[model samples]
Target: MDSSSPASASPPPATAETGRHAYRPKLRWQPDVEEYFAAAYGRDRFALISEALAHPSCYSCIRVNTLKSSTDAVMHKLMDIVSENGLSVGINGLDIGDQNSGSNTHEGNSMVHKCPYTGLENVIFVRGSGPHVLQYDSQPEQSVKEVIVSRKCAESVLRGAQVYVPGVLACSAHVERGDKVAVSVAVEQAVEDGGWAVDAHYEERKGLYIGQGITAMSRAGIFHVPHGIAVEMTERVYQLPSFNGTDILYAESFAS
Candidate 1:
């Protein structure tokens, strides 16, 4: 399947405002046009685009500012709260260890980790694993900045935005001189070919995965840089060194 496709077309016009903006349905093309989109991109792309147009565009997950806390801590705390309150949750298989431990001999574990949230950013604690942040809350008193990291970067670390050299596609044309901007992942659709699936469900897909970094180079210079972090996410939302600090405290207390 060809990975490249044209960008999404312009959305429909907004409705007349009556005090506040009134909701309006997106423009629907004729059946033939709809069929063409489905055939070209596949069903998932169609649904994702439709959803984006229908609602305020939102990414699937948000990475937390890890400088404030570590992902392990946030995840642990999130799980503890959930279990204590008796909540049922479904976690993606990738987040935990492998589902097929009996048959698969691979010693390594799955890469992803799933944590539940009571609300958007409130994380419950899990035993031994440590504390985790459930959601990112607005800190009006404290200045918080965000940036988009590609799924490529997110796969490296679950929280915060630490963009690598290769993942950056295009930065805001005007972004320059350490301007703080919210980073979002670039969304793309997977294509299918014949009976074979080009994009496997297990294979990680590209989208906004984390938020991090400052603009060290101009949009022109990004393509030129060969190494180093593109964006430095001081505050990550996933597992990081902060957990070690918590562990040290626990150890010291126990020793005493």
Candidate 2:
């Protein structure tokens, strides 16, 4: 699906060339197929479904390797990881470790919790929050280094994946290791040459700000390397706990 800006309250203005309405999330479906679904599910319902599918799941599920570790052990390790990452172990105002008191619990937010079901003691749930209001151009006087990634990469980043070299399409001039960069995506678009292009030319690019990260490689290194992580994401528009370097826990599944 074409990822329209999730933070935008409305779509961008119509294009002057085509004079068509603004882009909408349609999963790049054929006209007839989209029409069929719209008719079957009603236009409004189909639109809702398309928008929802473009976003990531709200929570990630980590099924503990019970043979190697206990649930409490895994939980404490996750808390430690959160602390190492500089993320709050608290939900709302309550600490993640304090489960005894319900007074400070946030209604819709949870840092982490063990599965409440009878048979799923080893299942741990990590809650995520999304559609955060990001201040992209907060410092107008300072030039922000930018990295443009593929749409697929941007989507994966929203789901808590780091930016890899292969996914990087463009990087700002002078971008070097340790540089903080604004990460965006270069969505595919038709070209006059009867081909599609995903090149990232800042002003011409139609994309959304997914997150910010510190560069692991210089601009030259990113394009030259065959494969490796390019950017280490520090802040994401949709916040999710990444399980990349965890020892005994991995995101076994996602809860829609």
**Which numbered prediction scores highest in lDDT against the true structure?**
2
lDDT of 2 by residue, 5-89 (tens): 2221111221223311112223556679999999999999998888888667767788888888887888777766656655554
Candidate with the greatest TM-score versus the true structure:
2
Alpha carbon lDDT at 48, candidate 2 = 87
Clashes (backbone N, CA, C under 3 Å), per candidate, total: 38, 0
What value does the lDDT take at residue 72 in candidate 2?
Answer: 81
Q: How close is candidate 1 to the true structure, as a TM-score?
A: 0.33
Q: How far out, in Å, is residue 19 in model 1?
A: 22
lDDT of 1: 0.37
| Per-residue alpha-carbon lDDT of candidate 1 for residues 1-256, written as tens digits (9 for 90 to 100) | 0112212221122122231111222434467998898888897898677655543211112243466676556555444433432321223422232344432321122222333544434222222221232222234453333333333444443322245556554454444546544344433333464232222121121222243446665554555666555565443333322122232112111100
User: Which 10 successive residues of model 1 have the least lDDT summed?
Assistant: 247-256
Off by over 4 Å in 1: 1-149, 159-161, 192-209, 242-256
